[model samples]
Target: MTENKDKQPAAEEKAKERNWISASLWADKEDIRKGAERYGEVKWYKSARFWPSMLVLILTWIGAAVTGSYSEAVGVSVILCPLCYLNVKGYRWSLLLFAALYTFDRVSVLYMRAESGQASGSGLWWLLIWWLVIVGATLTAFRIENYRHKHNLAGRGHYVKDTLIALAFPVVLIASFMAYNIFMYKSSLTDEQRKALAFSYGFISRNTDGVINYCLRSGVELQKFPEQFRQTYADEITKVNDWLEKDEIFKSGMEASLQENKEMLYEVFENGRKDLIRLTIAEETGEKPENLVWKTEYDRMISPVEYCKLMDESFEIMNSTGFFDSFVETVKTLQ
Candidate 1:
């Protein structure tokens, strides 16, 4: 009977050891393991709420990554968010900080760039705003759940064991995100697509302004033949320009719009798509892109001054993004 009692304790210890992987996530759980002030502490991980909290944290981590610009606040917020699951108090505090940091990062990016989202015009800020809505919903739901049925877990305390436990969550979150991205890239992207992506990044390096928001590209994805691609871009531009000279559909609209706008319209490229040189004009003039209605194959749209600077040896942007993008799109639509 004594041997059976000894074996029972040994088996229990082994079971705890097995769960230590996930059990390390809890503040009170670790305190109990270390024989600290953790009497009567429940194994909260056994609660179904704990798993749901973990799932939510994982989703938040991904959302932060998707909307993040290359900023320190973004990195910190992404890493720290997952660990918020470590303790309920920590979860609330950490997520609030993340929301603040995300706002800071988004605003800072807009501030740092000469082009404000509203004034200079961008959809990237809208993307950030969308994430805010999602995160806000998540937080609101959390509050409702907490209010209705509190988990009543102890808050985080200053202990090396707990600190280490909290830190591991972020490390895992980051590593998992990276792995997921790599896997997605490898599995989903074709060789041509990846080459196009690389060319897009290369354009960022060459541009004097040096804004290569990875999420947005200048509608160019040329990879097969640069020389031929360039010629195709030129040819398409000629067609568009020629059409502009002759077409009345555009002329009546352009004349009326230009009278008010007074700026040369150019193609503003975005995430694998095109926007407008003047955002309001398209809506203001009641102009919509007709299928095959656009005569221009040209994709790179910049001001005359910016275009001049791009070709200048000093600026070093040689229209690679636009040229390649035009070629690929032309092949898809026309060829």
Candidate 2:
């Protein structure tokens, strides 16, 4: 106990003078010259504050990847801490210049998204929002870095010790949080239910069978409609609805994929029926259909790319005319 008490005062005394950068920031040129002679350059990499921010950034990405979600990934702004440290203490304009360049690149992506029906809102509005986020983040980072450097709260240490200590908190927190969630999730299911879910997952993921099943099963089921010559797809409605309502990420993609496949399947059916009539006419009359009838007889022998255009056009027709829901009623009576 006496040894511990003796060490405490000495440790506190060392801590007071440990912030070399802050101590030297206001000292004379001669003091800085002497300190550099002993400690070398005070790089941002030496900042304990910078290391912790980097640790947060790295853990956020790992969380996103493990959860199969993007919210944590979006938290990569935590990295701005160290970058800000680099700029304010080293080259003040570097962050601003990099921001301008990155904004220009992202603008092209945002514009392309707007054109592809993937993004909402006006181009000007989107540009304003992005700039707001970027500018706000840059300024916040600058303030944080300024505070860290000015106080020299970022104490120096061996790189390995600094890195391990910086990473310890986030790693422990995320690991425990994820572990608890996993345990609660598992407890919510019965062993039988879990096995059944595993089986269903395998059935649904007939292609990969790797880890997760990613096929648009609902869309595929919907596409099997009238072509379900063996059995109509009307029966799959419950499964598809359950699948869609169970998850929004799945639900959002469901509509577009279902729309595409629905058009393709429906058009393929119509074209097949029309060609069947022509084939019967040819067989009965012993002659190919004439040019005027040829247009209705053949589907233009389109390539896959051309077929996509036709399907997209067909979706507009089927959707606007209410053919999709009404056609389901017809198939429901297939008994």
Candidate 3:
């Protein structure tokens, strides 16, 4: 009888431990309902997770507004506002969403830098630290939610006020940035500079993607029509370039547009060069290439020099097509 009494206490102790573990590790509807009854709906707003997330959210918006990344800022705001709301309201899945977003954004940034041949250097370390902080913050948020559930201090409130407040950050920041752009930046520009900027935008909208698409689609037959295609394309480009070269405004606008998008241009040309190499090797090995290679009906692989020349001419010809007379008329209207 005494032994049975001792065992009964031991079993009770084990049960308590199990209950504690479940409460800390899991949150179901019942526990949340009980928490709401115990602590009321506003419990989430008072959470340690809530204020810090808010601070970080506001700081992020501020950073974006200060930098020239207005569009990116607006995009992040749209994505994060709802996540922030759900997170503060004790939804555990919000933490997962946060981690996933941070990972994708950072990885894409790194990939773009590498693609552009920008050295990571110390920036990589900063990115590593940033990733670590994101992971740590997410884990901490999960722990906070768990703690609240364990203590019956968490509840999913209507959070209408919280939602409005969260959404206001992005809305206000975007509006402010737009006002600054229109009143400050645009107003500061001279008439000539404004015209140049407009011309630059028009030129890129007309030429850049069309040139890239043409390069990716068209191929030069260096053996059969080598001199013929090259000569004709060069003549067309020379005519357009020569006509535009006389105008100072056109030169400035074209230079600025090209420089601004040099990375994209470089990527297109580099990929084309790689495709040519891949096609050449595939022919030699009698194996299929992994990617589509641009080739003419002749389907003959050429030397690297010939490939480079072909790409150069293609870029110039595609950029020059229909742009010469169209932009000449555009320039006249601007004047």
Task: Name the lDDT value of residue 96 in candidate 3.
Answer: 75
Q: Write the per-residue lDDT of candidate 3 for residues 126-243, one digit (tens) a residue.
A: 8777676655555555765666777767665666876677678677767775675556541244466456446644444334343433333333222322243335345444444444
Steric clash pairs (candidate 1): 220-325, 221-324, 221-325, 222-324
What are the models' TM-scores? 0.31, 0.32, 0.44
Worst 10 residues of 2 by lDDT: 209-218
Ranking by lDDT: 3, 2, 1
- Candidate 1: how large is its RMSD? 19.0
Model 3: which ten-residue window has the lowest total lDDT? Answer: 217-226
2 versus 3: better lDDT goes to = 3
Model 3 misplacement above 4 A: 1-67, 81-89, 119-121, 168-264, 267-335
Q: lDDT of all the models against the reference?
A: 0.41, 0.43, 0.55
**Candidate 1 C-alpha lDDT tens digits along 1-335:** 99999999997796567442333333243323332223134354542224334544455557645643223233553555444454343344554555565466567656534231132445566756555553553344234334333444434455666667777766775776456445543234344543443343233222312222211123222222333333545565444334333322232343344323311122222212333333323556566533224324434454433433233322213344353464345333321
Best by TM-score: 3
Model 2 lDDT per residue over 17-136, tens place: 646434432334433334434333545544322333344456557876775544234423433443444443433244564466446656866764443334546766766665555544
lDDT of 3 at 325: 54
